[model samples]
Target: MPDSAPPPEFGEASHEPTEALEPSAADLSRTRTEEAVPHTAIIVPILARGVTLGVTTFFRSRRDEAFDEDDLRLAEELVARAAVCLDNARRYTRERAAALVLQRSLLPHGVPPQEAVEAASFYRPADELSGLGGDWFDVIPLSGARVALVVGEVLGHGIEAAATMGQLRTAVRTLADLDLSPEELLAHLDDLVIQVTQEGHEADPGGVSGPGAVGASCLYAVYDPVGLRCELASAGHLAPAVVTPDGTVAFPDLPPGPALGLGGLPFESVDLPLEEGSVLAFYTDGLIAAPGAGKEGLRRALTERELPLDQLCRRIVDELAPSRPYTDDAALLMVRTRRLAASHVAAWDLPADPAVVARARLMAARQLGTWGLEELAFTTELVVSELVTNAIRHAAGPIRLRLILERTLICEVFDASSTSPHLRHARTTDEGGRGLFLISQFTRRWGTRYTAEGKVIWAEQPLDPDDTPARTSGD
Candidate 1:
């Protein structure tokens, strides 16, 4: 097309003049100017899946020859390929954002405060290209002044892995509430994963299942401040690192049970006796997998155990995986062990006789006086009396009474039988069923926990009456 020709209007047709008209002087001047700088342009629509994303305009100026059919075909082909790439990029960005949001929302915002372990955590998502993986960590406060620490990782990345991580984390918390042993908790988690895998296979027989469809690894550890011990079990996870108060680091040889979803192997728990102020480090494999990071580097990072856990967590990440946008998701949880002083705990074995209930109450009252908690002696004595009488009446074998003085006073009664106790509303005429009800009215919270030897019925009473209004009972 000649540069002198006028551009056609959109949705308008061009018609040839019936007769030629002489050009005006102004028109002749315009034509001469246009001829001096000749230009042509072609526009091609960028299409993906038969939908036009946009248009690419190719312009040629001062060209001796105009664009031909071959040029148009080449432009169309190039734009078609570019369109597909752009569409893919757009889709990936959306999915990556959604996955990140889901993962963050599902993870714990902050670790809850507890008496057993002082903990801090760190989490880093994978680089954009790799997407996010299923790495998670949590610190759960268990009954009997204990705490459970968990670290887990699913096999793949993106939304599927994140969803799997959330499910497994929830399962761990539920099992922790039951106060299951580390080995028992892992066994239950393994069964859960196997069930999920079977369901996924049944749903999609031909295609690969979800990110964790094959398997995942986890470490579950429970720390008892009273016992000064940590019981830990792993499901194909790396062993945890323990740094003693004297600055010695060691990774205990933990039995590596089969990963979750692999059903036959038995999980075993190892009891690690930890000293007061010892630092325990739990992390996913990504920390060591990073470049220039390994067990030695981690040990070096953890040597200064006196530093606050929050700062120490950052230091570990900076030393191990300093660069941003990690290739894989990384999680770290560190806890400093704390021991309950022996002076705050009192325990005694009582014979299973109705006559001993009064003696048990007297023992608890005297312990309260020794702890200078005489104001709480009245309620504490009542709690001890009712729990002892119930155990003596309903359960079998020897009964033991224990009083623990902390922020609140804890009274516990242990009996050999595993039969759980139930809280009942006693009718006015009933004399026997009123003991548990009276105990509940006198305590802030109460629950039962089963140990290897027997079950313990524990009640917590507020040390200060003013603190009662701010607290909620967990009966």
Candidate 2:
């Protein structure tokens, strides 16, 4: 071959024999002595969509017959077929790499520390058959020392599924922030999926496309450490496996609602008490979908409690998957519950009167001193006085003040009114509207939440002594 020669066009073949060919740098491997040289050879350039990738060469030994046009045509046909496959292989490699990066970015990088439960998760994408199947898990920290465990799997694979998984995960977090129960959260998520499906159908008027829009299963649970209880709801997902502290394995019979995007059916939520040190496993179907073994096998595997939660998750995955690479994505999230003891909390009911404000302030100071948070006592006392005064002045009777010692010092005032308190700025002459304003200035954060009984105004102050204000009314 010579550099001056134009590259071969489509359906063209070039033939060269050892006697006519001029030696080149790349042809050094083929160069041989006259007695050892081949009689003739055929070269066919592999073309994919008008682009030449490489050439296929065939050689004949000294005794073999000379290569002819018929042989060259056959060689061209074979290379043409190989070219298509080579092109597809290249495309698939590029897409898989992009999908892997997208999947990793969408998933949670690390679980943040929470006071209610210890969580660990493992995710393995189906790298071979399914190119980036959508399987994801997350540990969301909620208010009141509670944490939400989530696991979801989008039905199809590739970039579409990964994108949908991310969308659903984001929706779940937004709903969780609203302090919605598991049942209510999924209901909202189902509606969101319905909207997405409609948009997909409109985008492709002919029919459904792109992972079939909202074909996915999700399991959501919120665990409360105060009561050691977990409320669970599922949307066409497998029941979670719960291993008790005493080694009892049970998959609470939770109602499996219809998968998301199906509007006819309603979802159900169940509440179960999980004692301290109990192991709760939330996973997708891929984890337990062995050839013959199913959820029963998963239950058996989860019964072993000697290993740590992180180690247990890996062991379960290794045991259930076959020797061959996975055909579907798998994700497992394990949570070990830890309850706050009675000593960590203090509560008292006070009459709706101005006199009780003094008593509430004393109680807050005493509790803070007991918990070695004396430095926060000045601000805590001011917050307690303001909240109690507001409850007695504007709200109904049966007011309650509770103090919780956890990662922070939380003071909550429960009243029998549903009115939401907002932080309003008061002018220097405004005498009555400054209660909440004063409380906000003294605490790190404050908010109000409604309960079945009434609304509770809560404020959180940093436990670190350095975070406490240097000057106070008491000072």
Candidate 3:
């Protein structure tokens, strides 16, 4: 108990000293003993979003010169307080890691080098007890004709929230891959969260590392290549902001539902017009939710119609912050839409000639290439080939292929025949029935919509900036 007795090794819990992170007994002894043991001190760093908030530490020591049962008890009690600190620090670390990883791994590294349109982004982690809050935003290029945009948040903060955010994100990516409808994907994710929570799954969710859990609020949309329209869905998240051609910010009215994991049905995706020279901003609530953000703050700072997207992001991060770096997590995503060099069109025809098809191919390629949209071109051609062929062969009268790119490549074959194309499994040797099959195989998404001007068949594929080796059914 005498100060003369050499300080012990760094034990597991206490500074009792087993193996200090330091070197040797001589060095340990050489170090000031007062520096070694003192009263006790505990520190907690607030983590919000994914950034460090501030550190909170407490100091205490053995009442007696040496830690006795009562002193140990005090240490334990101190630990209880420190637990809050440690837990917060650990949460901040994990959440910060999760957010940074997600931000880097999930978001498009940067706009395509030579894109026709300009794009940029900004990120800020919440500063809080454990910046593990779950706000997230992401963008994925879909088939050359379209791109997928997402913004969402898992409930709560810490490892659980990050994990949940990751899970929902994965679900979005997977469902997007499956080419399922946005509505279907939301439903699927809802089911998944419930299943994981009530039961649990091996798959990790959001930023959480281990078997995943938690739930989220999400919005996923597809931006078309040609028309540049957006098809979006809301799941207990804030309504999106659209900066129009004339500098008008429009916020869609989102319907009601609990955030994911609270338990319920999936929210459906809705379609919106995405015009040229337009900017759309999607963000988690943390960006807009201060104690008094209300709608006015968002309208003025983050979602003002005339504001540039980069400016919007900066403003959101600047204004409306709680005391902590994250108090809760936060995320922001923005995109600017540019018009094609020239409008792409299906020329009127007297006959369904090979020349027409050639023209269509040339049109699609030129627009895609000029727009720096290599990803949607190949599939667009493939789709054009299938639809035009179908129009010429199966239906009578003038066949027209008009491209209405929103969420999918809507290929309309204005055939006299009112017959709808059906998706079917093909036989190995069969060539004729393979038209729709090829479209199905090549694209991540596909479907049809009946318009006044005949029927349209559409498909979606992962938008790629480069023509990397494509994945097959097996891949």
Candidate 4:
């Protein structure tokens, strides 16, 4: 019997092998006794990524008679049509998989729990045909300032669109690390993109396609935990929602600004406040673009659900990520805003010996005691003691320490070294090399950064009483 289903438009053509129905005379007799036999049958293949994943078979009985040659021929046509549908579904799956992998690499692995606030981010590509669009998010830590944030989307789809997203996101981070204002940062990025495009044209001897790539819509924001303020710039981007504790909130308005790549235009920055017990949501258009659902649908979802920004972002996908997964690429970045009484002091050019670190720790403890944070001071001293002792044993030159009292206790150590601290399991006879591991096991989070002069090792401890009280040392 001929196979039932349409020919698939897969990259490689499919050659189906025909097989006869497997029914013995005995089985046929059983079928006859039960009712009759199938006069018509249809077979449909379930495909994914251009491959037939599974098949669904259907049959119809006529006048209680068994299926014959004519009926089998009709079934073949039905199966042919099924193949086309299956192939299309597979193609979409492939596109989504590709976009997701790329987006994951671009975003941070995951943000650790922060003080006085929570953060969550997500990214999904548009329908498979649209490929990956330019929607991105970033959170940057500033020097004695606030967390810099950005969410943006380019205006196209496909491989070119994906490339543009990558370029713009990288530029945003570079400019942010330089401590550029939102307006100034975007301006530099705008110029860089145009410059790159022009340079590409110069490099291309042969004829190339259209102008490099158009600019994108972006929301640039800065959240200061101490000041309880959020400064943002909206460039042809959607309004960000401000969710309140009572579950009643609205999207804040902002001064208009031109999208990136638009020449002869200027952009404005808007600053706002993040009150206690409030959630602020920043997302791309995909969150509002479900079929037959518009802005109202989004508004209803956010308001009625009373979900915080982080949870809201996940809800958008978990609850409404298409009945059978999305057809397009999509991405989202959300943060719950809050205020905390936090302060940090980083002093350099201090002695690198153990005694200096002891003094530094005492100094930090006194400062904390002055600030009515004696508990934090004790914890900070313990952390500094270990870090400084290690530095004294291994490196030479000056050391620095940063004491930050936020919702958590954060102590940072700076030494004239680039080699990362070691964290290893030690025996009773061993005397060293467990500082990093011990801190990691005890603190809420600990990491090292490559500073301009040397390196900075930092650790955070939560003040929450519900947290685990166990402790560990360098190993």
Candidate 5:
């Protein structure tokens, strides 16, 4: 039989090698086997959506009998069924490829180096036939040598889940920058998920709706290097595994609220004091919940305390799921806590008197010089004076000034009052409004955060290289 023939609607082409086929010698040669032995054959072209994919061939020895009308009809029916199946498979393959691409693009490419916590992550999408699912993790660097570790999963598979994941991840970064507490961040995230689900339904009534729509779980945590503390919150997600420096594993008690978009209840945050060198792990349920892998396996995988984080991740992947293709999307983020030493931080109490501003400035200059940050002395001294003066004037007595030397020179003023500071442009006639304004000009950035006891107004100035000379002078 010929591999392909003219459309049956146009009058099908059939060949009996015992007879000469039209289109002459070439047609006969193509339809004939290399042996050129006489034979009778029926060739049926397989068509999909009006395009010819290939052909189905049925050959019979010429001596037996030529193909009858009944036989031809049967061959046509078989090829018709095969064509539809092939077309569907091709479409599915294309769609899956696209979904996987979208999912990968939505995930973080790499974890940025953080001084507070060393982070490493691993992610694997489900096998192709299973479709792509939404699984994502992030390491967001926050102000004051703090980092936010996140892992989230959208409920179902394919492009919709991946898209929803991207939306949630973006919302997290934005909220994290606002310095929202863990519980507060999740609350805002829940609101966003509700908004997304509503908008998705309104925009596409038949698309992206139903049970799995907008259902997701997230584990959000913020780590502070100076305090060696982690504030964690979860939204119907798995509890994290914490490995102490001595390799003892423990899972902290944290409230896991209902999955986002479903729970209107307020999320609660837990404060965990992470010991120095403790390893904290955040992951989607797939890693531990997959068949044949249990929480025990996760603990065992993490118990290899001697391994570096990257190797530890590989070890976990190999031990937990050695299969080539994962059945569900899996993501794991491991962070090792590193505390800041006293040598890097300096704090002192300041009197509420104006005369003490010079003393604060002098202390700041001496500390900056000790840290090989003389280039920042002239600028940092003015910043300390302003922040302390403001705290003494606008806030209460027993004010405190703290200096932390990390990637930047952080000058903070702590007071007994909860009043937050605002930055405003000082009019030329005003002598008072310029404290914050001048501090703003000399520093890279500044902001205020409230602690349980009081509020701390902090300013950050980029630390110049040791060899670099002073960059600014007092105003």
Candidate 6:
């Protein structure tokens, strides 16, 4: 018999005998015992598509009837249907596992320490049956003693959603490096989402097409320790909960911009001045939408701001979302605001004259000496001279030179002109256009940021030369 075929009855003839032999006494006794115990068994292979997953065996005994052809056919049909269901479940399990791994790998494993805020984060994926949802959060350090906090969510679930989440997270970081304001960053992100949707539609014209194909929401906030203020903008995301040092909880009303991928909507940013040690809780909607926890519950959870940031994050999640499987993914980032010490920051107003550049250098050298960074004076002075000279020559009005002492030494030159400086490679005969270039080479990193009064050209120098490697001017 074939592997898929049922076994024949015991003591049944393999073929019809040409001449039947008379039954002996022992054979007759055996037949009588077999007849006394009437039993039958049928085996059916569980086949899905063209492959057999397993076999099901049905046994019947002590009955006048046995399993016939009709019974075997019914058994095979039932097992085949069950096998298809099992295969689908298996495929789903595999896909979910892959998506979870991809999502976790893409998320930040650790947040580095920065001067602006002490931050901690939490992320939990959705339940097994629901698969993983695309919810992510990050703390990115920016130039000039500032930090960017981000929390975003992509609609839908599975591997595609996780991939989209990673893409958005990376784009946010890249945009943050340019020192864009929160509103400006979201607007750029909106354009990117629209472009991605258009490309996706082109790839699959017959498939479902719309903003829903790439619909997402995000909240980007920049915290400036020097200014002691935070500028926040949202793309159809929830407002963060603010908890003061005195345990007062308040949610700042933010302009709810349209969700990403929807074109032609402008995003506005709100600048909030926070007191020292105030706690800002940034989270996705899943945290508040959990069972038994809503906006009120989130407020209640945030009351215990006295706890350490890491502990506070855990406490809030435990109180609201918990460790149990949720229908949606949840993410939380809690940061305590801090102020840059007055002693660490030094600024001076300089007249737009070549003579003032020497005084500016002297002031910076003296400040570095006071801060015990004398080793970096030579490079600092050169950077200061180049930035100030450029500002004096090209920019209008009085110039302001500011130096901030943190993990790195930051030199900033502010002017009333909005035109940003460009770094150009000068020929052997050229005299000008080398100021910004030389600044870029001498400093660890340098960039320009626009201010309301004008524009500020800033450069960062490493505090310890031996520990930090210098990068090329292109960097």
Candidate 3, residues 191-273, lDDT tens digits: the string is: 77777775543353344344344445788777764566676766677777777777677787666455566665547667777
* Tens-digit lDDT string for candidate 4 (1-475): 6555686653322333333434546656787678555544445454444566566566654344445556555655666577677777667788768766775566667764455457787666664444456677777765333587778887766666767777787878877765556777767877887777778878885865644456578788877776678778877788777777677768787875877667567777777877776677677777667775455665566675555556777776554445544654456666776666544543545675556766877787787777676656556677778887777777667777666666566677778787777677777787965656666766766656554577767776776534874453221
lDDT of 6 by residue, 169-240 (tens): 999998888788899999999999888878878899889633442569999999999989999999999999
* Count of backbone collisions within predicted model 2: 0
Highest TM-score: which candidate? 6
Residue 39 miss distance in model 2 (angstroms)? 15
Which ten residues in a row are the worst by lDDT in model 3? 11-20
TM-score of each: 0.77, 0.78, 0.58, 0.54, 0.78, 0.81
Instruction: Report the Cα lDDT for residue 80, model 3.
Output: 54
| lDDT top scorer | 6
Better of 1 and 5 by TM-score: 5
Residues 266-345 of candidate 5 have per-residue lDDT tens digits of 89889998899999988887787667787788987788887889888867866776675666777788888999888999
Error of 5 at 395 (Å): 1.7
Better TM-score candidate (2, 4): 2
Candidates 2 and 3 compared: the better one by lDDT is 2
The 10 consecutive residues of candidate 1 with the worst lDDT sum are 11-20
- Position 175, candidate 4: lDDT: 74
Per-candidate Cα lDDT values, in order, are: 0.80, 0.80, 0.60, 0.66, 0.79, 0.82
Model 1 RMSD in angstroms: 5.9
Point out where model 6 deviates above 4 Å.
Answer: 1-94, 128-131, 209-214, 322-325, 468-475
